[model samples]
Target chain A: MATEIVLISLLKILVVVLTILTCVVFLVYIERRVSAFVQNRVGPNRTGPYGLLQTVADVVKLLMKEDIVPRNAYKAIHDLAPIISIGVALSTFAVIPIGDTIELFGRQIKLIIADVNVGILYILAITSLGVYGITLAGWSSNNKYSLLGGLRSSAQLISYELSMGLSIVGVLMVSGTLQLDKIVQHQTTYLFGWLPAWNMFLQPIGFITFVTAAFAETNRLPFDLPEAEPELVGGYHTEYTGLKFGLFFLAEYANMITASAVITTLFLGGWHLPYVEYVGLSSFILSLVYVGTFCVKVAAVMMFFIIIRWTLPRFRYDQLMNLGWKLMLPITIINVLLTGIVLLILH
Target chain B: MGSNGKIIRKKDLNFWQRMYIPEIAKGLRLTITQMFKPKVTYQYPDEKFVPPPSFRGRPVLVEEQGVERCVACGLCSRVCPALAIEVQASETELEKERYPIKFEINMVRCIFCGFCEEVCPEEAIVMSNEYELVFTSQEEAIFGKEKLLTPIEKLRPRLEWLKNNR
Candidate 1:
């Protein structure tokens, strides 16, 4: 039975990995479309309908292109960089519960690949491994620009991670569980009558802090200083090309989707909607709807991210650092205290 | 209250302010407004956008009264920074007269800088509002006289202006 369960988990992991890969490819297309619309320009529309398969063409082009490893690059580490990136990215989705369990082929299958108690911690560890790729890619390139980008990315991640981790402490406190699925189960109630089952209502400060730190953690604007063009040509991936470079690209976007999913699960009440119980809907249809809801929420966060990219000017390195350590850290600490005080009073 | 200088403004935020209630409320209101607001987005191809008149676009060659108004001066070609314009002119049946027989503009190379239009002596080539010039193949995009020239019937108003003057 244990062996069978392991086999089932393996199958689920395969599906989840494929899903994440597909999302990364399609997300690029979505970003281009969204950015184009905002700038009053028509984006890619040649490959497929509305240029849906443009990413596929791009993938082909990148794959066919020359694979140049810089002369001075540390061969083994450079060779292994993208593998680490994609490995971490693909594996991080293991803990992401896309939906509730569904019964199929006389077997019950949980929506996620793994049901780990330390799900959030697993995510943090996996995501942090992405910096290895960036650092190695930059150091391998032996370019000044690439070196700066690598250093910037590493420093930025470490700085923002404090606030990010702190922000989630509130959620863990309120929900009283580190397991994400149970956290979802907890969001099935109302505050008064009108208020929905969203932690965003109760822990607004925590939500803000979480999302703000999340942007920085993902190296997204206005915290995308690591890959800031005009200053650093192509950043850490400057020397990478073909399928190796493709891995880094995939990981970046996959991390983005992961971050979005994490945010949705933590603060926006995961798949739980208030007053709308999953009673009559068949588990299959229910999961389809649940995954659909999950995707929609993720897409919305992704859109919000892109809009901020367009709307907000990129912060200077100092401003980013100061914002992370000074403003955000203090705010997160305060949010934690407030959450504790509220929880204590309510009890 | 007396030791105002010592205490930082943020050191003592009111409950509502510290809670970020006002700002979050404002953000929530704005999001709701955005939800109801008619989307300014226009879906291209499926729903073609009507670009404003001043929207600068592709350079179009104009043939007026069945005669190319280019004058073969090469001003548009020479002045074009992108060097996307190629004009091959030949003498007409009319004595000592030269008109562009083969006018081609490679849009793949054209920057749409509007310099070509500005430098045109006879206003033969001007930027058009038709932005749907994307082509799959290079041969199709490197437009020849057949595909390049806007018919005189299409440009009667502008042609008549040229006719009334020159």
Candidate 2:
């Protein structure tokens, strides 16, 4: 039984890692294509059909390029930075439930890799650690631009993290659980037999705050001041080359995928589509459907991320700081307060 | 400038503008709409862009009936700002007094300025619509008479456009 459990855990880990990595690769492809469409240009359709293998080609190119390390750089930390970034990005996905339990060979298998009770806290903690990677990379690079980028990233993380944490407090109050699976289950019920009881409907402000903060956390455009190319010249990864640079790039897309998943799990009802249970499908089919629903939701969110990146210009440093502090923080705080009061009155 | 003739400081944004959500939404809507619009990018390489007659690409020697139209007057060589063009005149038996014994254009130095084409008294050099130029070595970038010559029929559109517009 112990052996079986161990095998299953290993299998889950392999599946999750493979899925997330594949998603990251394709997300890069999607980002380029979507940006092209927005700009009225054809981007990267030459590598393979519709540029499906462009990221694959890009990966090969990065791997083949010369790996250069500056003579004055801190070798150990500089090497370790991308690893830490990618590691944190991948590990955060372990707690996110893609689908509910499914029966296989007379044993129920849960889709999540690690079903930690403190799932939300684990995500928050792991995400916060991502900043360390950027900071370390900057400090170790021995380049002034890298140092500035790292500084800006760390400050941005700290400023936005407050509102991000507070924003989710409203969701937590409504769902009354920190486990991601529980949050999704909480959202399965319908209001007036039509609308799914998604947290998005209940806590719209929380949804907005969570999404904006997620964008900042992912270091995407508008909030991508750290890697603001016009100013910082590739930011913390300025000194990075070849595979090291590829790792940072991979970590970024992975963070984006993870953020999309987190948002889906928290506010958009994860694997539960509205009225899906009413279809009366078999257990196995239903589980497959759940996975599909979750993927579709995540894809939609990812498209939104891409669209917003191309649509909006990068925020000014002061505007970013001001928005994080003066606006998002207070709004999230109020949302938390409102949710708490309502929950208290109802109970 | 304001109607009062005083330089106006930028007007302060209202609460809605300060909030930025509405403006962001409008921008997003515009971009989403644009995503469905026709893309302006060419497939390139597979589908070569046929440039208009007015397009200035690389300077080529216009060859007519298996011979260059150049009288080898050396005007193009003199007018070239980058000194990209080099011409050597030699005695010819043809009606034209001289033909270039050696002509080379260093594409690396050629700025596609159309000066060589403009300064040619014989209309021997014209900017043909052949923009795809890749050289593996510095030595290879210097095009000899063979590489510089283009059939007059292939350059008809450019010649006609030059005739009408120049």
The candidate that achieves the highest TM-score relative to the unseen native structure: 2
**Candidate 2 global lDDT:** 0.93
Off by over 4 Å in 2: B1-10, B62-67, B84-109, B136-151
Backbone clashes under 3 angstroms, per model: 0, 0
TM-score of each prediction: 0.74, 0.92
Output the TM-score of candidate 2.
0.92
Residue ranges of candidate 1 with Cα displaced over 4 Å: A282-284, B1-166
Give the worst 10-residue stretch by lDDT in candidate 1 chain A. A271-280
Q: Write the per-residue lDDT of candidate 2 for residues A1-347, one digit (tens) a residue.
A: 99998999999989889988888889899899888988899788877888899999999999999999999999999999999999999999999999989989998999888899999999999999999999999999999999999999999999999999999999998998899999999999987878899999989999999999999999998899889999999899999999999999999999999999999999999999788788899999999999999999999999999999988889999999999999999999999999988888988
Q: Enumerate residue pairs that collide in model 1.
A: none
TM-score on B-chain, cand. 1: 0.77
lDDT minimum window of 10 residues, candidate 2 chain B: B39-48
Q: DockQ score for model 1, please?
A: 0.10
